[model samples]
Target: MAKIEDQRIVIDCTCEVQLQQTIIDAVYLALKLEKEICFFGNYLNTSEKEHLQQRTAFYANFVKKDIPSLPVSVLLLEGKLNKLVKELGEKYNTILYCYSGAMDNRLLEAFYRSGFPFYFSKKQVSNSNQFSKILIPVDFRNSSKDSALWGSYLGRFCNAEIKLLVANEKNTEDQDLVASNTESISRLFNQFSFPWSSVLGNSSSWGIHKEAVKNEEPFDLIIFAGSLNVTLVDKITGTFEKRLVNLSEKSVLLINPQRELYLICS
Candidate 1:
């Protein structure tokens, strides 16, 4: 439903205990969509490699217990991560990393530069049912619009409820931008068929994160948008947009501004 089929997902399995389930769940979710799931197995130690394979096999078997025709593959990590990603970039649509707070910022910048729909989660997320609540943070930028459409597609695919959070910034210019962004997003989502809503917020990441966690009903996903074509300079300078990825409590989906979803898939 999300054009997940016929897509390739390269998973970085170089994480430890707490992240193991994240990798397993990622593979399971991908298999459910019949996507080409590829695990980078070369960098892992023997035990880690074995664990990854065993868990992958378990999920694949579970997914295919009755379906019998799931698409999955195990690829060697081969060499450096950036190198592997460069190679995978030609074929894969998304590079998934089950990272905690330990990952280097440089590596993330590399993924952004690689122009893939880089999907990452710092915590475990359940794939047992459709995502019921997806959150999209809106700003007056083209990237935010891309994120809105992408989140809408995911909402439709999962039959989820999608909400837009227009963060009210401090200055008049920023506040006006948020209002304009909200209106534009409302018009855009109106074209889609899904249960959707919107709320104006008084702050960015912190407020949104707090609201998300404080909700008696939690959000299943957070989709962010930014100049995915990030530069070394931007990382050094530290952009607020880049900081949104640090929200590790829930599953976060980031749409690269440099890479648009293939129209064929749409």
Candidate 2:
């Protein structure tokens, strides 16, 4: 866990259909850990009066829920974030999400900064889902480094058989090049001490990537790294980060490279 400047945030617990379970998990986790929580939620969905009673385990539970966001409004989530933490007698804080990415993740990009502490689910799926296999997409980029490190740590925690996958792009003329490097992927996994079988999968093209996301056998979770500064060109363009949130029947944990975490709760 990493710690940043003493700033607390109030992330919106209010949301639509696809994200409801995650909000519950996030709020419950906050309450269960006894962290002084500033909740931004809907009265109908999650009321402070109802939820305060739910947080019985934590020793010092400081929380305030039910702050509404108007239609087409962008309130200073950071300010509210700090207020929540300060009210709870905490130091550093800000609001965040378990499944935010740069392109699609608004709450995070607004709040994330150098040396800021953050936390997301290491277990990347809803509590209702069960897993026997975990797929990790690994690359050598800085963003991928966070993905791989977190994936390894998380896979071990879940006790799932870890599959370390890498992308291999071979043009028609480069078949030999692709075949030659078959063993190299295994070598990379060995160096990391990640006990995983290797596969040639691309996030771009068909076949492997398609099957990876659409497997009928049930993956429960998919972990991959994407660009940190994910911006969109078109107004209607749905970012990949957002797609993960909407697409995953399970939970998606989007890990960026430079977040510090402070554990107010155990």
Candidate 3:
């Protein structure tokens, strides 16, 4: 992670009042990383744009009082948000979108296929962006290693505790490898001085989500790795990835396997 301070973040500045919370959360992420924040300012007309500008400025000030150091910019969508995002995704390292649960599926597909690691969340972020506990669901795959590294980076950055949850069926063929992978992940996190632990369980994403919902202590963030879907078999029966995203309430950091993991900066 080469001091990843220069980040380009694109967020939809829709005029919906409900979206305001998510927008502020997104800005908080940018502030955490001191990254450049970009907004699609064309989503609103003159009066609405003025109101939104005020709101955005307020959030920016709330996060960082030093206005000169905060690199915030607005781009006109011109009714071509999808196309503009495709271009931006190619040029940027990190992209954060305010997912209001009603975005077009096609647009999301574009984000997935854009080859950039992106963040999506419907819930408001914590007032303090210091993630106390971070969870990474591990499977016996190369992408899981990538995800673990990311979790370690974030854990160190936030001075947080990291945990890797290994979920698998009892009858799975690679049970031994799963155990080995857990040990490997533990060692990796330990190198980063991240207090780490492991949880072994056989459950689906829905079950994990249910437990998190009921637990007194919930994870602040869940990190996931993107699948290539290279093989025909893997394409047909995708893992619990999508379900994990839909069923969880915490923030998600999705890593695109196609791109170099080093590009996934804070």
Report the C-alpha lDDT of model 2 over 1-266, residue by residue, as the tens digit.
Answer: 22422223333443333333434445453433333234333233335425533432121122222412211111222233323433222332433333222223344343234222233233345464243456655543444444455455444444445665554545543434344333454444455543567676654222332345554235655655433554555225754545544554444445544444333322
Which ten contiguous residues of candidate 3 have the minimum total lDDT?
A: 207-216
Candidate 2 local accuracy as lDDT?
A: 0.40
Candidate 2 TM-score to native:
0.51
Which candidate leads the pack in TM-score?
A: 1
TM-score of each: 0.72, 0.51, 0.70
Off by over 4 Å in 3: 1-3, 15-18, 41-68, 77-86, 93-104, 124-126, 171-173, 204-217, 230-243, 258-266
RMSD of each: 4.6, 9.5, 5.0
- Candidate 2 vs 3: which has more lDDT: 3
Q: lDDT for every model?
A: 0.59, 0.40, 0.59
Candidate 3 yields a Cα-based lDDT of 0.59
Clashes of each: 0, 16, 0
Q: Which clashing pairs does model 1 show?
A: none
- How close to the true structure is residue 185 of candidate 2, measured as C-alpha lDDT? 41
Model 1 TM-score is 0.72
lDDT of 3 at 170: 59
